[model samples]
Target: MTDLDTPAAAPPRAGALRHAAPALLGYAGVRALGLITLALWSAANGKSAHTLLTARWDSLWYTRVAAFGYGWEVRLPNGDVHSNLAFFPLLPWLERLVAALSPLSYADAGLLVGTLASPAAAWGIFAVADHVYGRRAGVCAALVWAVLPVGIVQSMAYSESLFTALAAWSLYAVLAGRWLTAGLLASLAGLTRPVGAAVVAALWVAAITSFVRERSTPPARGAFGWRRALGMLLAPLGAAGYVLWVGHRTGRGPLGYLDVQGQWGNGFDGGYAFARFVGDKFTSFPSALAGVGLTVGVALVIWLYVSCVRQGQPLPLLVYSGIVTALALCASGYFGSKPRLLLPAFPLLLPLALALARLRTSRSAAILGAVAAASAVYGAFWLNGSGPP
Candidate 1:
């Protein structure tokens, strides 16, 4: 069916929120456990969980943007320059707005935005899985996402949840054949992060495929419409608009954004740098276990993509997850941050979620509970240890 195929959405089984409640509640419970564990662990170490969530790592960069605006940079003794320009503006912009409207500090505002966006992201993930498999699979998918080793990032003042929320809803809109809604949300997603391109790519691929289908299939119900064409036009504007603005501001033309990223040691090198980093981990006996772990993680990610393809997921999902995976894994730097980067690639969990859905309720719940506790403990330890970049 074409993008105009509104009837592509299944007949109303239940009101969206009413149906998504299980996923949402399960997600909330998992997140709560994580936060509680973090709180207790941090307290025992004389640290504040709130500080970790709102003031550390990239959260500092985001709050800096909200408080002082951009054009900030950190020049290190090693000749590395970290520029705030490397960060997309939408999250910081929202933080600024939230701070202006409330008594909360910029950091707190950022945490608030992420806290709200986490549930939205979960709901959107539930929507997608439910549409593709069934209600039970959807619940499992959302819970699966919650139990991710880096799932604690979803609750921090980070852009991952915000971007995922926008991306997931945009994808849902695409699957529902609401072309305009899809494009609009995709545009917003693009505004949120560099990975937003994955959503734009998904929309473009789906729209182009629809065009190809229309060329062969006779015009009738669900045929390509002007809305699809307009959606195709709208999908890239957010990213392009921001990049072009940076270009003009930097006087470097269209590639100025790339220069900004480079200033922060970020660029696309097709995983070469990442491979080297992982390989180096094996140079010392003390680090070889981590090296092997990294290799296994990469292999697992790749196998999941293959499973998605073999499972015959819709083109939009396959394209979206593929690009998200490639970008997250292939990035030249931020080797330790790759897992956090994959937060938006929720579709990768569908295969496992579908399998989990087949288990008896008690068995699945027990397994999920154990996994969730482990994830929560690991999240606490992670933040207390090296932590995410």
Candidate 2:
């Protein structure tokens, strides 16, 4: 059988359903409660829950992009340029496509995008977990992801879920040796978010590793070596091509997107810019406390990356995690959103999911259900009031 036709192996599944029941039930129940509570919360806050659910925040931005082609820009007091061009094109492109095919408005199209992408993300989470750990781990990973407070984003008209869905599937494809699929998805991911580079890096690492591994092995009869090598080469092309094209259009080099990010108060400054911002946060006692909290958070992120690497996680996971953590922490924009920005890292979801999967079914369900409930409420309240997380 061809590699593509070979059934991908799953972790031990004998007791997986029992182990995963609690998480699944809890996640669904809590999210349902959150949806209701959030709507009520929005109503109480003098914002129409209907409007809150249907409009505002990044949703508005995406809708605008879909309704009108790029060219809008807002010059902030800080001289930052908040431009339509800053948004990667895929989400809006999807919105446009969806809207064209149906009676849905752009906003509804975005909601549809998030709704569909969330499940895809869950599937990717399951596939990756199954590949790396076991079926139990995979089940737990999907539940954790599905129930995360950030899961609220998945229900809204945002791009994170979409980007994550693409990234996760691309990683899965690469791990399964479907290089072209990996590249195609990675390209779509790139069109979705500026941080798509992380996905590209993961694919590249996997390809290079595969290339080296195949080289060291004795030739096997009937092995499609040339086809496999070509597949590896194709994986990173999507992101690279888009970025280069963006550069071409902007009259900048292929790194034009990075320049665009800088114009919007974001860029990689080798951590120096973030340090300066953190230093300012320490000037006031209250802010200093917040700064300390952020310090602990950054430390935890570093720890997670180190732990994943030490625990024999896949190289693609390590590469993606390292890139995302670096990008979030070292980012020069709204550093407060660092946690949310890295939410799509997905690798961090594994250990906790594995732990939950090991729990007694009833107890695990109760615990995870409670957490999911809280997360949903928090997600709703956050979205209704403060915009996107």
Of the candidates shown, which would achieve the greatest lDDT relative to the real structure?
1
Model 2: runs farther than 4 Å from truth? 1-30, 77-79, 387-389
TM-score of each: 0.96, 0.88
Q: Which tens-of-lDDT digit does each residue in 231-289 have in candidate 2? A: 55665565677677768878898778677777877877667877887788899999999
TM-score of 1: 0.96
**How many residue pairs clash (N, CA or C atoms closer than 3 angstroms) in each of the candidate models, in the order given?**
0, 2
TM-score of 2: 0.88
**Alpha-carbon runs more than 4 Å astray in model 1:** 1-4, 7-14, 222-224
In order, candidate lDDTs are 0.90, 0.74
Candidate 1 lDDT, 94-164, residue by residue in tens? 99999899999999999999999999999999988988888999999999999999999999999999999
Q: How much is 336 displaced in model 1, in angstroms?
A: 0.4
